[model samples]
Target: MGDQIELNRRYIPRLPSQTQTQSKRKGAGARTWLVVSKLGQVSVEELGKQTVMRRTGITAHDLRVVEPELSYPAAVLRRERAVVVNLEHVKAIVTAEEVLVPNPRDPRIASFVYDLEFKLSADFSATMTREKAMEQLPTDTPPEASGSRREAKMRYSKPLPFEFRALEICLQSVCKSLESETSTLEEEAYPTLDQLSAKTSTNNLKRVRVIKGRLVSLTGRVQKVRNEFEHILDDDMDMAQMYLTDKLATLQHEGVSEDEMDDDADVILLGTDINENMSSKCSTLFASDLKPNVEELEMLVGSYFVEIEGILNKLSTEYVHDTEDYINIVLDDKQNQLLRMGLVISTASFMITVAIVAIGFLSINIRIPLFDFGTYTQWYEAFGGCVVCSVFLYIMAVLVFKFLGLLG
Candidate 1:
């Protein structure tokens, strides 16, 4: 009986440890996303690549541009149904009515996610309140009150589209991040450069080098973002494409078939006809109020472009390069002084060596006429003569160096 029990126990599988099970669950959750919509609805789900592609109606290639591991450049690609944004540290897919951000739990993006949700919710509530107030307005108002009503309606009705609001938030976040980093860099760089000027040291040099490298990197990023914005601003079609919400609303109101709407590229190709139809549909009273859709996006992007331009100017290499040049001049002066001192020492050493050789001959055991004639007194006088000659030679060497302009 005991042997049978032991065999059964050996065949049975052991369960995984509690920690291992928890870690597996945690890894699974990391791939999940927190999706937010303009209606203030929030849902958490494990959104795979195919699921996101299906949800946003974007191609796999567009989706991959915002993938966390790809390290893609700052881009804002307008797709058939989605706007793929891959700005610094903020990667998201924005559609007409919804936004899908991967890894929303990451500390880097958590604040953005929270802010987006709050703003959307607030906008929704404010919109509801505004609609209710409009409905409550009396139909038999006086002429002056009617005018005020028209003004109020105009003011309240022109809220930015959902996508533009989201884009605005993203731009604001990126700008704030850049501004903060720039401020920090300036703080660190200015003091370090100044200290380096006052007194050069290994540590201070390393700090300045790091600061300059940071400045160069920041400048590149700012320039890249500016170029992307410029590219969109220069192309009217690109800006129009970014108005995903407006296009969808227009197409739906025009009774466009689902098949036609599915391929936004074709819709865009036929935008001229659609725009005329939209213009005709507008009431004559409000027709004058209608503006080009691209105008809003242009103004939006242009404002940030100006902000980024200012940042780029702040990161100018003029100050850094000038400081570097000054440091080089100081270093060169010190090096030249070292070289001149070494030359002076070498010349004195050579003169002293010559004097030593002359005195050394007297110490030789070989017979010499001078040695035979010299007593101790003569020996002392000869030694004094050699010392005097050495002094003279050293002075002559210094004079030659001065004449050649090497002493300076």
Candidate 2:
């Protein structure tokens, strides 16, 4: 019986602790994401890693870059169908038709959502209005009517692709955030630096140190963002891949000829076709080009790059960094002045010590000829002579120090 019990104990599996179970659940948790589309509607949904991969056509490694918990550097990666953005606080996946933002309830991200809805819906409304006007025109219209349409078309500006619009919002939000932070830091930093320069104290030094640290961190982040922009600008192919709408249209045009076999293959194709059909009558619709052009995206990114560069310059060398250098120079000069003053005082102390030693020796009971003169006049003479000798020694020390160029 004992042997059987021992065998049973060894064979049975051990259950994990409650803490371990909870940690596992948290690690593999489902996250909520906000889906914003051209319709100007925002929908909240819970999604897992697998679901995100399936929706975005990205791998697990690419998805990890945008995870909010991870401390990944600024990146703008273009996948086959989506653009992954991880700039500072904005973590999102932008597709040709919509954008998926994680943690939409976050206060930092609220502005992005608002801008996306307002701008995208407004563009869609404008496009719809233009299409409707064109559709109402007569098929056998006269030359004058066509001329009016052409004039109206010329007056209307072209709307950017949906992907570009979403990307633009993200860049704008990041740049705006950076600028606001730089301004706030400047307001606090300049005063602190000025106060420190005027009066060096423990409290003021601490404040300057803290401000400098923050500026350094901010500069690094700005540099990373700028580098990402430059990386995209340098590679034409990378920018070309970012043209999701154009690529979708090209794929759709090809799909009609080859007869896509799988039903799943037609999902994006059908969506693109429906969108193309709706805007076909509009004169400003983006046409399908045989070769992809990146000029549009290049111009967009280049503008933001300039903006970010301005912000970085403010943090790096224009304002805070320059102030720090000036403060250092001021502090060094003050230190030298203090040292010289101390040296002068030390010389005066040495001269006083010699006078004090002579006076002490005469006051002793064993004094000989110096105390022989009993009158108070002799005492006064001795005191005056000590004072005169001390003054002479101090003046000589001052002249020597000045000659050595140590008292400047």
Candidate 3:
């Protein structure tokens, strides 16, 4: 029994506890609840209040106690051996990683960290090995590994599961924070590349979820837009399939006419008297029509054929042009994102350079005829002035770019 207990304890995850009660309600009486769950099978409710109290280092009495002096009603609840935090004081739940917000009322809000979780899977180690091998393997090794080989492979293995798990948790925290904000945005709310690039938040809001046997990020709001577009594309394909089916049915019904049959054909010879009479009439009509049909019929058919071809050509050209336009639009968006990223990097580099220059400048002592500027105090003041100017310029440039719609 003791050994079993130890084994179970070894697998149990360590819980990190943090508690914050709202002192006051801010903006629209918004209440944010942070829910932690595992595989949707476990909820906070399953975890008893006592367990939470133990994990969080809060006394059992605190769970039952109420603090009316605190501005908001807050409590911790356990579900499925996990903790749930209910907060009525938070105006927004931002991710712990950087999130790009347009036209934020307060810049300081950008730094707000969100709590989230990351799930680490055992398959990641194998995936890493496969990726590394692909990058550095010899020509003799197969590009793809078989299931048996994958199971047996242990090259470059490292025993850092704990570290990897911790890192995964940290990443998860970032993803969750980003996801909260993204969920609030509409599907069509595509941030421009510039906006995405200019975003300097350290919080990441996303979670890794397994779907259809694939691991995918479940955080960003942009994924909804992608799904919406995919749905639209599927609908279009369905419509096209229905249209083609209708066209095929019409073509099947309007196949070759009886009058076009040969005089001594097997079809006519094998038929009954009624069919024979019909065949005879069709043959007579065809013989009479054949001579007169040559000139006028050919010209009419030729003219219609030309018009049909012209229409087809026009449609093909339009389709090509539209496809090209779509490609160009996508390329332009990519280019814009790259441009914005470059700008941000350039700005950061410039600021860093200014800082370095100011440090060097401050370290120097200057002696002037009009004034004695040789003192460290004077140098410090000059460095401070330079720093202030540099910061001012950075702000101005950012604002200018934003105003020009070059920065989001």
Candidate 4:
């Protein structure tokens, strides 16, 4: 009797004392409940209560939220348990982890992220008991059978199962990566509007390329999320995820052949044809329930989407404008400097021309000082003076230009 009691205690999961459960709930400041189940028949929004209608049919994808008070890590024993008893609820808890961002410090990480995770229903652990099997056996059943049953019970221990932690951990990691990006953009790497109004430099040019690349990356992340949601939503049949556990139970109660389950291909074919018939009902209910939620999430992300859009648009616009103005300023300065050099060269040319004309007259028999001070000198001397004056004029022009810091 002692051994039997010990065995039962080891196999069966114990319930927490009621007092402890109440005290734990009281201490926990806030709680969030999400509907993880996807039975087309059940909806929290439609029902409007803490209670969800219990349905026997459940899947791993149906886990909704992680209860803060629940010691989720301790409960989940993946190695020990082949299948969770209420695995759908466990999956809901897993889904909850991915859907909500625990710490939403960065606005760039959209309000929520959601994705479907599928597990093989066929792989679930066996729930049928040895007691039930024995009741159906004949009185002549061998003693060895009981020994085998005990050995099987000892070997296959039931695990204390809850939500899988990996899903949330992965999503949170991505969000953290996103938050870092957003924070970097909002703070250090990007310049403010006022700084942008300042002179453009090589540094600004570098920043332009970096900002553009960042914009592209962020856009890709958001789009990827959008595509995921759309892919699920577009198929009304898949979106409904109607697991008719009760209906199947009812059918079983009506004496349907047990062999029907083994013929999977036929079941799938029949289900597809029936699904086609029931499409309208499922689609209507699913669309009505899901569209608002998807849209609401999109709406929350809508602001951030617009924000990224605005940032990209703003960055592109400013980059072009600043670059254009910088190029224009540089070109204008070059043009003016060229004109200054031309004016100086032209003045020197004019002086040289005047001297040549005077020398030409002196060369002809007009042996006179070009600017007479009432004295006569040799024609060669006057000519020599004219040549010196022209050379001097050219040198002076070069010096003046150099002094003004314009020629270079």
lDDT of each: 0.73, 0.73, 0.35, 0.39
Question: Judged by lDDT against the true structure, how good is candidate 1?
Answer: 0.73
Off by more than 4 A, model 4: 1-179, 182-281, 284-331, 346-408
lDDT of 1 at 276: 30
All candidates: CA RMSD (Å): 13.8, 14.0, 36.9, 20.8
- After superposing candidate 3, which stretches have Cα over 4 Å from the reference? 1-294, 300-311, 314-317, 366-389
Decreasing lDDT order of the candidates? 2, 1, 4, 3
Residue pairs clashing, model 2? none
Tell me the TM-score of model 1. 0.78
Q: For candidate 1, what's the RMSD? A: 13.8
Candidate 3 lDDT tens digits, 27-103: 23222222222111112122333333333222334333322223333332221112222222112211111111111
**Residues 103-129, candidate 2, lDDT per residue (tens digit)?**
788898888878877887787778777
Candidate 1 residues 150-238, lDDT tens each? 88778767577778888887887888888888999998898899999999889989998888889989989988988887888887766
TM-score of each: 0.78, 0.75, 0.23, 0.32
Model 2 misses residue 17 by how many Å? 35
Regarding TM-score, does 3 or 4 come out ahead? 4
lDDT of 3 at 299: 37
Pitting candidate 2 against candidate 4, the one with the higher TM-score is 2
User: Mind sharing the TM-score for model 2?
Assistant: 0.75
